[model samples]
Target: MLIDRYNSQLLMVDVQERLAPAIADIAGVEAQIAILLRTAREMAVPVIISEQYRKGLGGTLPSLAGLMPGVQPIEKMEFSCFANADLQAALSGNPGNATILCGIEAHVCVLQTALEMRAAGRLVFVVADAVGSRRPESRSVALDRMRMAGIDVVTTEMVLFEWLRSAAAPEFKPVSQLIR
Candidate 1:
């Protein structure tokens, strides 16, 4: 199915300082997420970033913050951002009923958020390359679980292209410039 840009928002889930260093394939995941953020910014997509607990886990990565300035970061204590009331309100106010999810700890925050979003009647599309876990098995399990729950699994480039929708679009140059 085509990713409806007008009906999509980027939800960057906890790419926190202390947690990110230990995740598997950390470098690759970071790179992909950077690209994803750049694409989202270039395309005027709204982004919601959640810091699991700022007093403990730390803020979203600097690279991500650089791309999405003034992102409505929903600080949460819950493992899932969906569990927070303020986050829910932010989500409901967005133009999209679809979430393009990314960030760390694939089997935990990423997984939980995807499932909850789906349950809330929002279409969840995860950027696989932008998600990671300390244990590969755990990450794989989460992906399986998300797929089982009918979440649409996608990669960073796929999301970029899908959001662009057509090569002839006026934003084509800026969007395509991201991949290069």
Candidate 2:
């Protein structure tokens, strides 16, 4: 299914300062997420960000945090964002039924969240290139598991173009420039 921009929200999971450094190719992952965040803002798509164990993991990376000024990251101990009441409430508040996930430890938080969200009957799309784990093998296996469970494994460009839908969109120029 195509990702309907008006019917979807962006969820950034645990791209914290302390935790992010441990993910392989974290720089590339963050860059992709940045593109998503910027596009989300440009398209008026609601965004929800989560930070796992903020005290230990520290807050979202300064570079990423700055992308969405004034947006507070949800603090959660649960690996699945759906398990956290606050995060759940935040998600429930958004009208969108589809969620786009991007973040660290694809095998852990990202994987669990995608499965749980999918099971809950919401359309879940995990941006593969925007998610990472310390071990590439772990990320690979997690992607396979998510796919087997019927989750859509997508790339940043796929999302960008889907969200834009066409070159006639007013956001076309600015959003398209994000990747370049």
Candidate 3:
């Protein structure tokens, strides 16, 4: 199913400083996440970010935090954001829409979150190119697992275009320039 910008929300899960460096292809993941963040802002899709044990992992990376000024992440110790009251509360306001996930450790936090979100009956879409793990195999396995669990595994470009729907969209020219 195509993502509906009006009903969908973006969840940036545990893209922290210390943890981020350990992720394989960290640069690639960050670049895609930047695109997702920009697209979400342009499309008016609400965003909720989560940090797993910030004290240990450090806060969200400076590059990402810089893009999200004035926005604070919901800090959680749980592997799945839904397990935290604050995180769940953050999502409560934007219920019934697809949840687009992009973050680190694809085999852990991102994987667990996607499964729980799917089990809750939320249409979940995990941006494949925007998530990574310390090992490539772990990421690959997790993506396959997410797909088998009924989550839509997509890419950043797919998401941007899907949100826009058509090139005639007013933001089309600027949004398309993001890929260049």
> Which pairs in model 3 have colliding backbones?
none
Q: Write the per-residue lDDT of candidate 3 for residues 87-140, one digit (tens) a residue.
A: 888876767888999998899899998998889888899999999999999999
Query: Candidate 2 versus the native: TM-score?
Result: 0.97
* CA lDDT scores, all candidates in order: 0.86, 0.93, 0.91
Task: Summarize candidate 2's per-residue lDDT along 11-47 as a digit string, tens digits.
Answer: 9999998888888999999999999999998998889
Quote the lDDT for 27 in model 2. Answer: 90
Best by lDDT: 2
* Model 3 misplacement above 4 A: none
**TM-score of every candidate relative to the true structure:** 0.94, 0.97, 0.97
- Per-residue lDDT for 42 in model 1? 77
RMSD of each: 1.3, 1.0, 0.8
Model 2 CA lDDT for position 175:
92
Evaluate candidate 1 by giving its C-alpha RMSD to the native, one decimal.
Answer: 1.3
lDDT of 3: 0.91
